[model samples]
Target: MTVTRFAPSPNGPLHLGHAWSAIVGHDRAKADGGEFLLRIEDIDGARSRADLADEFRRDLEWLRLDYREVAPQSQRVATYRDAADSLRAMGLLYPCRCTRAEIAAAATRMGPDGPVYPQTCLHRPIAPGPGVVWRLDVEQAADLCGQLTWTDERRGEQVARPELFGDVVLWRKDAPASYHLAATIDDAADGITCVTRGLDLFHATHIHRLLQALLGIEPPVWHHHALLVEADGRKLAKRRDAPALAERRLAGEDGRSVAAELRHGLLDTGISFADTLLLDA
Candidate 1:
């Protein structure tokens, strides 16, 4: 059966964008008679709060989005640790002492996204160092993957160009698993066949695809829906409360009215498929 998931970070209150994503995931699953799962992506232990988790539960329920089951990421550290351990054994993960300052300075000097790291730590024969962050050895993994192909509901067939994205970090020093690893593992475990989320994650597909390739698994079909944006044309965030749903509800807005407004706004954003195709290329 086709399955989909709405994995939201429980670090803040759900907003209009979260509502749109929840509706999309639930409606898509209902249309296909599939299962919809709720995943709590609270891996950023330092930032996640229990109150935010409670608020998320309330907001999603208020929006009437149902799921088969919910998996809180904090409980799945062992799963991620195993993946890290296996990669460490395979030499695909390396311990780097690169600090945020080092990465920031490197990127700034490169003048913008300038291939941070320059793989300075790649061939270093140094022993496991302090602030050791685990990075995926993309070049070697690409040699194994050769080529990748995945289909998307909205974007059609997609190809990953690892050459464009060099070795990416899979786990931070303090976190056992990064967003890419934990999310993909959850999807595969839940047998999710469809992934419908906001377009903000389009760049992240490369990282996710590479990890899936390395783990020898097939990725789910992607449906990167246009995100809900504020009247200022900025994408809504969980942290920012520019146009939160709570405010709308406080302003006496109903679900039907909100959904209609969002649907209209999404298609009327002056962003046409033709334009997206050109830009995505």
Candidate 2:
């Protein structure tokens, strides 16, 4: 069965962007006679909130988006740990003691996420203690996997370049698994056939493709949608205080109407796609 998912973090209230992504996944699944699953990505211990997770359910109900719930990521740490263990057994994961500040100081190039890690700890001896992050050796993994590509529903075939991110962290000191590791493991474990998210995550698919190869998991087709941005043309972000959908509901706005407006690209600011930082398709 073709399965798509709408995975959201429980760190904040749902915004218009979240609603649009959920609607997109729901409609796609319905159209293909498949299933739309919901997964709560609350692996970040520092930011995740139980109350916010409850609000996520209410927001989805308000939007009338029904889905079968997959096991929450917070409860799946063991599964992720096991996957990491397997990768370690393959010699693809290595312990890194480099701190964030250290990497920032050493990095010379920037990728979509941030500074491309310079792999300072790739060959360094593993520290004899905890709090060590495990980074994937992208170059070695790519050499073993050889040329790889993935299908993007809109852009067609894309050659995988996992090295672009340069040895991304699979396991973190603060958390058992990083976003890239957890998302890939859950998607494959849950038998997801199609992955739908925003274009901001398009580059992430490259590293995911490599992980899927090394882990011997089935790869899913990707659909990267344009992100919803603010009137000022910056991407909508929680840090920037993007208006919450709950606030709109509190003001007596209909969820269906909001979904409709989002579908048609109708926003209060009337900004076009070009106005935003849309990357090349």
Candidate 3:
């Protein structure tokens, strides 16, 4: 059976963009008679608010999106550590002591996320410690996997290029697992057949595909939908203080109507869907 998930971080209240993404995943799963799962990605340590996960459930209920809840990332730290240990045993992970400032000073080009690491500690014998992060050796991992690929529901086949982001971090000093490692493992653990998320993470899929290959996990088809943006063209984000869905629910607005409007490409006064659903080929 097809399975899809809407994984949200409970660092803040849910917004319209989040609701749209959840609806897409929920509806897609229902359309195919599949299971819809909700995952709370609350592994950001002190930044994650425990109460917000309940709030997220209420918001999804208000929006009429039903899903089977999964174990939050905070509860799966041991799994992430075991996955990291496996990678380390394969000689695919190395400890990096470089700080963000040091990497910024040494990096010459930008990758999909930000300044690429310059491999300052790649060959250095850095030990795993409180201040060190674990990074995957992308070159070696990709070589072992060899010519990997994944498919997007809308974009067709994509050749995996994990090297685009250089050696991405698998484990962080502060968090139990970096997003790439935790997400890749969680999807496989949940038996998710279809990964539904926004377009902003489209590039991150390359790294995820590589992780799936290295971990001997079955890959899932991807559906990266369009993001909801503001009139200024900036994507809606919680950090930017995007309007919260809870506020709307408290204002006596009908949740089903709002969801229908989003499906029809109509949103609140200032919110608009991206020009195109599919990214440019």
Best by TM-score: 3
Report the C-alpha lDDT of model 3 over 1-281, residue by residue, as the tens digit: 88999999989989999999999999989997999999999999898998989889988888888799999888888999999999999999999999999998999988887899988899998777889999999999999999999999988999988878998999999888999999999999999999999988888999999999888998999998989999998899999999999999999999988888888988789887773533333
Q: Each candidate's root-mean-square deviation in Å?
A: 3.4, 1.9, 1.6
Work out the TM-score per prediction. Answer: 0.86, 0.94, 0.97
lDDT of 1 by residue, 1-281 (tens): 77888887766667777877888888888887888888788878678787777666666666666776666888888888887787778778776777667776665233112444656688776576456777878788777778887776777787876545456677777666888788878788778898887776765676678778777678888888866555555676655654456665657667666665655554334322221321233
Note the residue pairs that clash in candidate 1.
none
Q: After superposition, how far is residue 132 of candidate 2 from its true place, in Å?
A: 1.3
| Stronger candidate by TM-score (1 vs 2) | 2
Error of 1 at 43 (Å): 1.8
Q: For candidate 1, report its TM-score.
A: 0.86
Error of 1 at 179 (Å): 0.8
In model 2, residue pairs whose N, Cα or C atoms come closer than 3 Å (at least 3 residues apart or on different chains), thus clashing, are: none
Model 2 residue runs over 4 Å out of place are: 270-281
In order, the Cα lDDT scores of the candidates are 0.71, 0.84, 0.90
Candidate 2 structure quality by residue, lDDT tens digits, 1-281 = 77999999888788877888898888778887899999999988889998988888878778887789889999999999999999888899998888889989999987767788998887888773687888888888899999999998878899998877888889998878999999999999888998988878888898899889988898999987877776666677777677898898888888888877877888766333322224342
Indicate the TM-score of model 3: 0.97
User: Who wins the lDDT comparison?
Assistant: 3
State residue 25's C-alpha deviation in candidate 2, in Å.
Answer: 1.0
